[model samples]
Target: MITLSRRHLIGMGAGALAASAVVGALPASAGVKGYVQSTIARMSLPEKVGQLMVQEVYGVDPTVDDSRNLSKYGTAKGVDVVRDLHLGGVIYFAWTNTYDNGPDGVAAASNALQEASLETRPKGRPDRPVGTKVAVPLLIATDQEQGIVTRFGPPATQFPGSMALGAGRSTKDARTAAAITGKELRAVGINVDFAPDADVNVNPDNPVIGVRSFSSRPDLVADMVAAQVVGYQIDGKVCASAKHFPGHGDTATDSHYGLPEITHTPEEWKALDAPPFEAAIRAGVDMIMTAHLLVPALDPSGDPASVSRPILTGVLRDQLGFDGVIVTDALDMAGVRQKYGDAEVAVRAMEAGVDLLLMSPAPLAARDAVLEAVRTGRLTEAQLDEKVARVLTMKYRRGIVERPLCEPALVDRIVGIPQHLEAADEVTDRTVTLVSNDGTLPVDVTDRRVLVCGWGATTTTAVADALARLGATTTRQTSNAPTAAQITAAVTAARSSDLVVVLTNNVATSASQVNLVKALTGSGTPVVTVAVRNPYDVAYYEANAELCTYSYSPVIAGAVARVITGRVNPQGRLPVDVPKPGGGVYLSFGDGLSY
Candidate 1:
């Protein structure tokens, strides 16, 4: 029996008080629900409003001596933005620590920063009870769209883009890709994955959605989006966010530079942009990130989707019945920030029913503004409570509210597992589409001299290597450099032997390889042309035969090689119409293989 004097008991009491403040002003195992209740009881009307802000991690400069982010001398000002302003969380951008191409580095950084933030309570306040820490763990989110849009490389498995998956046209294939993506994300400690872009890439001129969107057809895109939600959430337990709500598919402009407008009316909206988002919401997605584009038919104010109440609350919440967390695209992007200042954008987003104000340039300013709105009665405390409750609910569901210490060693074991790579290779095979081929393929290369040209030749060397493996002595040319003279020589050599496969991968600025395709078709050689990007290239440059590899991935490259060498039959049909030269529609979205 340990008995203590009154003075000693008082000292022990003081230590407990200190311990409570350190944890979150609650008991260690109190759980998020109990913690939220305790926290809500103590918050002032103004304090509750501050939790809605989700600001940019890079807003404050760490080098400035008196900088709000930190004082000069390596003190972390980044952590202060969340702690001092009592911000809800942060959205990582190019400035936060660079990821180690995989999830391990990201996970370590995310866990460390979030844990550090748990300390640092104003001294007098009862040490934050264990579970009731005012600074809820930071929500680690990123744009990991796999292929070209991947934020982390190397350690992270890079697969073909969403469009390539759409080209595959199998829900099972899409889900498998999503599962691998989810596992990789969890291993890295990123809880929030902003992905499965629901945007339909209907416009060929769509510079942004080129490889990001899953498909052009609404139904196909919707199905794929649903599959991604399952992969990231069900398979990995990461909170998956389906993004660019209401879609940005048909727009010609990129939102990063300016606000892109969608001219279609509300009815047309239902027909095109709404399906994938609707499916995603119905699939029980955890978070829905708003887009920056303007839909005049949906709201005539020229307001981007992030600020449109009709789009966010009226449609997504009221009509569509989505009760999940609503997050904004990065608020610092020119599409939104260039027009609306950070504070105003923050307020408007909250009013418009956005639950998370993502990556705002002025996080503290936004927090102050929301607090002021509550003080002035412009935004009620009840509204803030509702939003906080939703956020807290999500945290609870993710088991993050429990504050589990996941071992780093466990993370190392699961990343880049063999099964994931095997699945990715299989999915890649199903997506290879053959648009038009005359009998020139399946070259018995035992005696054939082959010439391969185009950006595909330069970018994906797998095509050339595949040909070599098939016993064909192949010559490769990139752009127009291995010009008429070089191409003519290769043609002369191959003319006496067998096949000439001219592979063209088009780029926005220059598909100069088109000229090479023309030369190959004109040379009176046995030519089989392959277009690895847009299918229309097949028509633009006539050849004896043609194949469309809708994407350029190592796996897709391997599948293309097998098809051309007659090892496998090309089973893909155009999901979108491959138009005539000078076609009315410049690009096709659903134009991929079905089987």
Candidate 2:
């Protein structure tokens, strides 16, 4: 056990943090829970219920997007909600929803929001009309999952996503990547990162969480999940969350669209799905995001995991012994929204043991519902206080109240620094896994005619650009769900080329990609298929050679090109098991081939 001073532990914002050697050695006062409990005791009922709501804010377009999110970072509406609603936090979406101003814009927006939250009684908390306004730092959270799910653009460091780290199989590298990510986020004025998708991708055809999950192996996933928690908490001081719990791995449906049911029994969940979350709790992950999926074995009520007390309080809290905040996946999703209205969903979610109501379609309605529930005895005051205290405890632990803003001046310098990019690139190179090969790779494009084709042509274009820089002749063709005629033309073009390299993305979601690749394979030319987003494309059809980059971004393309040209040997092993559509295993977990 590594023993450190109490000052060192608290400075890292990890005092009394679980599964830590240092925190266990500290005095009881070093823990933030004590401070938070006392603070909650002084709060009124409305103020306490207000601390449970977390809303979503957008940018640029007010009419098309959330009108309240009209502020690029914040407008009067942003301040209005903080003052009037007494909401706990706001989830920011940059490019995901509306056009957002880049780094400095985000910092300024965050600073404005924080300032509004910390303002005077009349300006800050409109609910508390009499007493002095107790300014609480709102939890500013976003999905910074790095690779395909990253919310930040340009100035933010583009770290390779979770599957990349899973391939490298280094706990130290996982910790380092998370630390770098956390530091960059802190600099940009963003604090909470919804990351490290702890779900094991046991099912390859899983549309939502394909490469986002680390691996299918429970032990390996558990190890990386723990390391990621430490990196975010001790190093980044950013609250890291393990999401879609009880696992979203095997389900074939996307929770954002509809409620997916887990077929696994309780024992199966304990053995396969629950380990990563268990490891995260032992390592002191600050938050856990509930999935909207339903598990019949856990709760026969047929409610999604987000509103099931047996799953949240019984399975997560009692069984896992996790006392951290329980955040629900966006309440606006069709899974819960289609069945229940926003207010009912919010009250039921609170009743089910969720600490924060995230991104409800009706934010004020949700807050009022919780208040009404407490007042009408639908939800006991003790129950309301339990959830609010957890939220307040996390705020204090994260030091959001003390230092909620970042210097906009340093946003440019601190974000996307060379060290962060270099580490990201290194991780990308390591995750480039060659699943199978017939000696068609290492295409010395030196004066060779190579046809690069794909659905998302950006990846193919990037590879072509890199090859052109290396003095190689290349042709590029891209489309969204190519027709049979388009596939025939691509095959004809490939037949005349020296080598054909096909890039595939989201083939699991779109079955048409399989047909296109099958058409190209019939051309009798040596075709190399690279699964850019979904790594399971190789299971359906046999390309001359198969590879996976797990992402189709800038940093990833360079690494893919290097591996094909033999500049670098791929060191990535498959993080998840590749199962065919029907039944058999296409490739077991930890399967990767080197050149």
Candidate 3:
């Protein structure tokens, strides 16, 4: 008889796991599939349906209800919701006040939820004298994508966003960053991360997915996506979810407020949008979150991909051969809720073959709808069992079943340690992209006055502080939309300073910021412009020297400072094309410079 430790099984990766199953090298109970089957057979219909739901709740403590959550999401006390609804998972958001108390608080809250999920319960009647513990454990999840989308604040290592990694063009860096992120998440008991966005980001004007996506090139995105999948799930410590399936990259719309439609032909999709998702599937990603957009090439049913059988079942499952869990994006978003009510959307999503219903606005109503559908023949009990089994299988495969609780005391020790912070800084240093230089870079700050001015006080202050630490005298001016007085003041300051460094946030769309850059550049003081949010802003205006950091995190600001001061060479290349003012490409993808 062959025996494999849980550690060995998790490290085996998805391909190895399947191969092991084919050879019958382990007992049925030791294999995830067999354990999931036996667990499903013992579950009631209500319990089975509950296993398909993952809700978002408010509060740092599971036993207490936050009034804000009740007012905003209408969620009850965290422990009660998990116990009463028998939820298979829970998602935490910073806005929901879940991270208000920091890492230890998060770990404690996660332990409470897990305790609730593992509690014994009556088999049928609430008044029963004897009861049994819940069969499956909860999958605690969060969007700790880092960069601009981070949920955890300081004391947690903040890595650069996806585009920054894309600019660095190192799969090793991508994997290392994800591994650090996974370690921190597992330390706090979050087992699932909705991250490493797989969208190709072909549209420069894309509202939602710009820097969140790795790159515009499908091949590059595919490589980075696969690397991150392995990184997050390497030891089965956390499950990685490659999101916005069938692609949400080329749309000009934001799915949170409205529906976005993609006009890719079948050939176009196979070439552009399908590569990263295909790569993710081959990498054995734990989940693929569906996009709420309509892709007519894949599904002509007029329903969004989240509820389209042709796309979810036909394209993703049949053609793509993805046998893992399929999760829907937040059902409360306007993208998926445009036509259907809460109840109907829940039923239709299950019909379309999604395994998990994430963050439904009305949890009880959604669960009741699924139960009714199963009873009334709209959805078969067998279908419900299949979905629940997938969820259970993932729980076991990811080691959540055996280790549901986290140690709060160790959270501080394991999260944001020195080595992880150093890795983040090294990655950030490599992502500073110098797009243009006219012999003004590596500023001689020794005895020179430098003025740092721009939008976003946090970003400006960070840059100024970094410069000050290097023994340069610096002045700062911050305004989101500079007024005439602010512009005049900044220009006056620029004239007196030996050099001026101006930071811009989407200058292409903000005429005021463009005017600020124009006024400072016109001062003839040798200005260096930094594009903080998107690198495409540099095309709108002229600067003596320009660089793109892709994000405005303090770490990125420090990296930008070092690049300008010649302490670090700018090594990052553009991940997407930057359009010129007249509509052609000013800076194509892969454009960068070094001193």
Candidate 4:
């Protein structure tokens, strides 16, 4: 590592600093705490405030302006995000076109952003000393939660969702999956991952956290959360985050659209919602993301956990003893913005013990608000320093300060290799739960005609291709909400086929899919229904055979195909209960059948 002294950082120009081999280098003997304290001591108010915000920019190149960039939030020009705002971190999103050309493109963009971040800015104000130019490297982060919440598309190994891993109940597989994901992320220059959603999905009707959560059982969720935290932080290459703290699993409302309330008492909260977070802390997770949820037992005030001191500081920081960084969920969400504007929301979260403000809709306004708060004694300078210190401490502990730049050429060699792909396929194969099977399975499809119908075009195409590759003569019907004509065509196609495989995504809520399944089952053909999104969909329809994959990725489709073809045995158990048409449990947790 190239070691730079304080004098060198101040004396060098922006070009010289960018060309240097190493940026923000710390001495080997200097402890992380000491380095962070020293760095914060010399920072200006603007510089210190900037270290607390992790903003988003829209582009694949740091210098170019992307059409999708929201200039009102920050700068559309990517380089300005680093130079003008001096952000502590930048988040990448597929919607912002940051992952446009895949791994190499992301790596190149990360390198450019880091170059801008490490460059020395001019000391203009009187309070800014000559030797303090703010040469800290950015903490690049992304939401690479694999299954349904993935930002990186193909060529990055697509692992199964969290509930699928929970169904398999293999901590070793969970650890291996996280290790592989962490390695690939580091290869592409991302230093932090917002993942391992530790929420316990006790409420089956929870709109957002269904398959994203590991399990309904708190003990099992704790075990999986600890394993993933250890896996992601292996070698400290990437920082793992346990999220939606205080739990978003039992709520019916989506926090993105509106605020959600959880009525669990303190006893119930500790028993049901706090285990995974406790386990994450024990496993030394680098960060914990606060949820935008209101729990009256934890804090009687109506403020959401993202802006509640009793919840964030009292419960998470003090009661749970989490000394690591505490980050908020995206500040632009309606859950936290109900009572305050962008400026007030940022200030309130900071006051409540959040160390990092993520994805503020108006990042500049938020920064200015915090600055004003500090000036007016609404928030102390010591409080701001404490938060910035936590961020820097994470950077040093995770080796982000030592290795800020990535080589684009190395990304192709490291990502989506044969080993990583095989691991993902194996994990997915182990997660295919055979809920019910009749004598119709393990069909001899060598020359048999089969009909495949599904709710999504991608799902139908993947399943059809997988079956065709296995020597079955395959025909596919794809529709989100099947029309009468579409259902009639599927029924006609099923009559000529030896067997029919229907994929359902939340069929319990979609009457059209239910009707489609009934039509196919009413025909004389043997039917196998696969609930690709949620296992609870099987209760809404009847079939000769039933299976649940808990996800809809290509890997899951291939695994389902192999399981039905008798190439792989079904080993997955249910992670959550399937409710009956009445009010009871249709299939309890841990219910599954092997071929």
**Per-residue lDDT over 1-595 for candidate 2, one digit per residue giving the tens place of the 0 to 100 score:** 1122345434534211221222222214556765566657767787787778777655432223345454422333565566556668877786434217666666666655565565544334534456544456678888888778887765677766888788888888888878888888887667899987899888766778877888878888899989999998789988999988879998889988988989999899999999999999999899999999989989988889999999999999998999999999999898877677888999999888899988888776787788898889999998877887788777767766556666666766778888788887787788889999888887788888888887686768988787777667889888758888888889889888887888887776666778888888888788888888777777877888899878776778778778889898988898877777787888877898987
lDDT of model 4, residue 78: 82
Query: What local lDDT does model 4 show for residue 499?
Result: 86
Alpha-carbon runs more than 4 Å astray in model 1: 1-35, 39-87, 90-97, 101-103, 120-135, 403-406, 444-452, 456-458, 465-476, 480-511, 523-530, 584-595
Per-model RMSD to reference: 7.1, 7.1, 6.3, 3.9
Worst 10 residues of 4 by lDDT: 1-10
Question: If ranked by lDDT, best first, what sequence of candidates would result?
Answer: 4, 3, 2, 1
Scored by CA lDDT, what does every candidate get?
Answer: 0.68, 0.78, 0.85, 0.86
Off by over 4 Å in 3: 1-29, 68-75, 123-133
Which prediction has the highest lDDT against the true structure?
Answer: 4
Worst 10 residues of 2 by lDDT: 15-24
Off by over 4 Å in 2: 1-38, 60-76, 95-99, 122-131, 508-512, 518-525
Pick by lDDT: 1 or 4, better one: 4
**TM-score (all chains, Cα) for each model:** 0.82, 0.88, 0.93, 0.95
lDDT of 4 by residue, 474-584 (tens): 999988899999999999999999989999998767999999999999889999999988888988988999999888876887898898899998999999999996889
| Model 4 stretches astray by more than 4 angstroms | 1-24, 67-70, 125-132
Measured by C-alpha RMSD in angstroms, how accurate is candidate 1? 7.1
TM-score-wise, the better of 1 and 2 is 2
